[model samples]
Target: MKTYVCPACGLVYDEAAGLPEHGIPAGTPWADVPESWRCPECNIGKTDFVPMEL
Candidate 1:
């Protein structure tokens, strides 16, 4: 699983535990982000997050 980081706020979106209630659910494909989710902390769109390697 990849880790996503919020470019605006530096929040780390973890695939392991999921994105909390504001995140995409487990097994959610990237294509589904637009309709399925939003950032928990800032309510920003999922597209704002970049995949974080570390």
Candidate 2:
């Protein structure tokens, strides 16, 4: 699975290890994650997340 990172705080979102505690389950693709979702570390919106290289 691919990964994404928040540009502002470096919080990562791995598609294979979804944040289940926050309502996202394992295997959830980045495309499925809601746009309203925010980084737990810095509270940055998903719009600011970028695909992580490798």
Candidate 3:
């Protein structure tokens, strides 16, 4: 699974274990995640995140 991290606050987002309570189910790809879904840690948008690994 791919991983993404918020540049502003270093919040990690893993596709293998998505935040279901936040409306993002597990296995949800980063590209599939809605633009409206902000980082729960920093409140930043997905655009602020960058791919970390496969």
lDDT (tens digit, per residue) of candidate 3 on 1-54: 899998999888899999898889999998899988899988998988999964
Kindly report which residue pairs in candidate 1 clash with one another: none
Whole-model lDDT per candidate: 0.68, 0.92, 0.90
TM-score versus the correct structure, for each prediction: 0.62, 0.88, 0.85
In model 2, the Cα lDDT at residue 50 comes to: 96
Best by lDDT: 2
| Regions more than 4 Å wrong, model 2 | none
Worst 10 residues of 1 by lDDT: 27-36
> lDDT of candidate 2 vs native?
0.92
Residue lDDT tens for model 2, 1-54:
999998998888999999998899999999999988899989998988999998
- Rank the candidate models, highest TM-score first: 2, 3, 1
Supply candidate 3's per-residue lDDT for 30.
89
Please name the candidate that would achieve the greatest TM-score relative to the true structure.
2
Assess the local accuracy of residue 46 in candidate 3 as a C-alpha lDDT between 0 and 100: 90
